[model samples]
Target: MGDGIVVGLGPVEVEAYIDFACPFCRQFELMAGPTLDRLLEDQLITFVRHPMDFLDAVSTTGYSTRAAAAAAAASDAGMFHEYARTLFANQPPEGGPGLTDGQLVQLGQEIGITGEQFPETVRRGTYLPWPPFVTQRAIGRGIGGTPSVFVDGVAIPARPGPILTAVQAAIDGAV
Candidate 1:
């Protein structure tokens, strides 16, 4: 759970604990991703995503775990941002079979995660244990749900506007 999949090299830290199978997490991503991207580009904040499998029981096929594991593999391939965006954009509903391993591989490929490494990692469940470990750590830290956001170690409401305001405040305070 230390540092998760980090992006950017800014002084401020923005951490998000998300579950792939959670609809609210998808909404948070869709609503706040662009703003976060802008912040990253501007080097205002270092975004750290903690992909978890907290919603695995909600998915009949354990989509949460599978998706999170795939995301970990994508992170290893240095394609985490693209793969995460793609996952949220094409998120599967809860209580149903999520994308199969092959479909996951295809999605990774569609996002330009080239080569057999990603696919083999996905199919082999190479990072399968990671999501659950993250989820447990999150729970241990009293994080009760998906889309939990933190700015400089303080929790913030997981909304686009609030998150933006908080990030801006952190930036202002840092300066």
Candidate 2:
């Protein structure tokens, strides 16, 4: 979450880049998000979200690109954050049920987005496309794997505590 969305807190900035279908992304949400949320509420930093869904190849839920497209469509319908929360809460694991378009829409419905056009939007590729300029740019910057996250344009190391520490440290440095 970058330029399209920016939530402010304090002097630091915490931006999250993730794919809905990536297990690691889900894990990050369950883990780092809370910390980021706290940082956000304290106005200690700004939170940005760059949602990506191209990890379709490892999907057991279907294809992430489709899910991502669906999420984007949901976003277009002004249900982006809600859809994101739903998607992560019901993640099927990496290389598992990643999220079929229909399911994505169904989840949306479960979460208050009642329009039936949601799934159809994905099927029709109505939202942002994969290989999206932003996604490609992120990948080009070295995001070959799922949960490939960067804080303030710097790639973060993978271990959880260390990564969290690094992110907070980055934010601290910014302040």
Query: Which candidate ranks first by lDDT, i.e. highest?
Result: 1
- lDDT score, candidate 2, position 61: 43
lDDT of 1 by residue, 1-175 (tens): 2527898999888999998888999999999999999989999888999998877887777899899889988988899988999999999887788889899999999989998899999999998888888888888889998899999989999887877888788878952
Residue-wise lDDT of candidate 2 within 102-135, one digit each (tens)? 6777888888876657767776777555426557
**Per-candidate TM-score against the hidden true structure:** 0.95, 0.72
Q: What is the lDDT of candidate 1?
A: 0.88
Query: Residue 110 in candidate 1 has what lDDT?
Result: 92
Candidate 1 residue-wise lDDT at 53: 85
lDDT of each candidate versus the true structure = 0.88, 0.66
Q: What TM-score would candidate 2 get against the native? A: 0.72
Q: Distance (Å) between predicted and true CA of 140, model 1?
A: 1.1
Q: Ten consecutive residues with minimal summed lDDT in candidate 2? A: 1-10
